[model samples]
Target: MKGIKIGEYLVNSCTMYIEPVEYANKIYSHIVEVEEEFLSPFKPLQNIKNSCDYFGVDYESRRKGT
Candidate 1:
């Protein structure tokens, strides 16, 4: 699959599977906000084990597009 390599992370340009929720509307709302603000809308590849595996840096503290 074609994707962008941001540091060591391979972010696939595809939509990921999100499980449907029944209750916990408040929690769902927070999740939506976090996805919009922090998580990028890219599917994580299965091959990638850790962020350092691709980016050549420590996995503890690393930013995307760095």
Candidate 2:
């Protein structure tokens, strides 16, 4: 899957999953913001991990892309 790599974390691209669409959207946006240096990475990474774990999805897939 396509994703953005921030340091060691991998935030996957927005995909149609069984989970709520908002979760995926948030993950994408949070990572993008981090990449763009608009926000610090800690909170967003925490939220992304929580969302992925809650939905039983793999958010940590390594790929470099927009």
Best by TM-score: 2
Ten residues in sequence with the least summed lDDT for candidate 1 = 25-34
lDDT of 2: 0.40
Q: What is candidate 1's TM-score against the reference?
A: 0.21
**10 residues in a row with least lDDT, candidate 2:** 15-24
Alpha-carbon error at 17 in model 2, in Å? 18
| lDDT digits (tens) for residues 15-40 of candidate 2 | 22211113333433324432342222
Assess every candidate by TM-score.
0.21, 0.29
lDDT of 1 by residue, 1-66 (tens): 122222222323342332222233321101122233222233333223243566576544444644
Deviating ranges (above 4 Å) for candidate 2: 1-42, 62-66
Which residue pairs in model 2 clash with each other?
none
Each prediction's RMSD to truth: 11.5, 13.2
